[model samples]
Each structure stands twice: as C-alpha cells, then as structure tokens.
Target: MSAELYDFQDKIAKIPEQEKKAFVLYDVLGYKYKEIAKIMDIKVNSVGVYIHRARTIFFEENDDSSCRSRRPMMSMVWRLVA
Candidate 1:
C-alpha cells in the first residue's frame, strides 16, 4: 500500500467506531446503503450521513496544516481509498 493509504488507515482508526464501520462498509467494501443500514441497525439515510461525517473526520484528522479548516472533497477522499 502507498503512504496515503497508510495515512488513511491510521486516520480511520481514530474516528468514531460507527462512522468508521459505516464508511468502510459503503465506500471500501462496496456495500449498498440498505445492506449497511441493516447490519448497523440504522436507517438507510444514516448510512449516507455517517459516510459524510467519516470523510470529514478523515480529512480533519490529517497532519496537513491547510486541510485543518477544510473538509476534503469527495474526489480526494476516494483517491485515498483507491
């Protein structure tokens, strides 16, 4: 894996457990929202919300000074996972 993937994994470990699970299921594992929601026992919409929060938390936890105040764009977020 690349350094960015390492950083992403580290950052993911630091977020809330629910958000981490939600993000991983939907984004990394390619699970459907309904599937994730069923597994998590949350409403389907909450899956999307958790994913959004996860991405935000991922960028916020980074060491980069400029990104501290900025939420990462979805494109950049996917790049880390990709």
Candidate 2:
C-alpha cells in the first residue's frame, strides 16, 4: 500500500520523528526488524518498540465509539451471524 492508503497517518504524524521513521519503515514498507535496524541505524528492539507504539496509537485514535457502532449494511448477514 502507498502512503496515501495509511490508516495511521494522523496518529503517526504525532509520533516523535525517530519513532515515526521507524514505524514507516517497518509497518508501511514491510521491512524485517533486522533490516529496519540496519536502515535506520537502530537496534532491533527499538524497531519493535516503535512499531508497537505506532499500532497502539493508531488503534486508540481510530477506534472511537462511533467507528465501532456498526449498523448492519446487510440485515441478512447480521441475522445469520447474530
């Protein structure tokens, strides 16, 4: 996916520069921990922390109550699943 498709754009923008770069490299670019470490000149564990924090922030921001209020688009699916 491209940068335009990122769900975490607003939250990610709020992250510190170092952590933001690490998150984009690992999460968006799909780089392995070791590769991200090499590219960013950081340790593998730091990469892990950045990715984790980024995900947490993204979900916390996006998962507001209104977003979770799913009105069933297809009543049949909700009836079957419910």
- Estimate every model's Cα lDDT from 0 to 1: 0.76, 0.61
* Candidate 2 lDDT tens digits, 9-82: 55657777877777666655557889989998988998888876765655574555443221421232234345
Candidate 1: where is the Cα deviation over 4 Å?
61-82
lDDT of 1 by residue, 1-82 (tens): 8887787678878779999898878766678899999999999999988887886787674556555322343455678666
Alpha carbon lDDT at 6, candidate 1 = 83
Best by TM-score: 1
TM-scores for every predicted model: 0.65, 0.59
Clashing residue pairs in candidate 2 (N, C-alpha, C atoms within 3 angstroms): none
Which pairs, if any, clash in model 1? none
Task: Report backbone clashes per prediction.
Answer: 0, 0
Q: In order, what is each prediction's RMSD in angstroms?
A: 5.2, 10.5
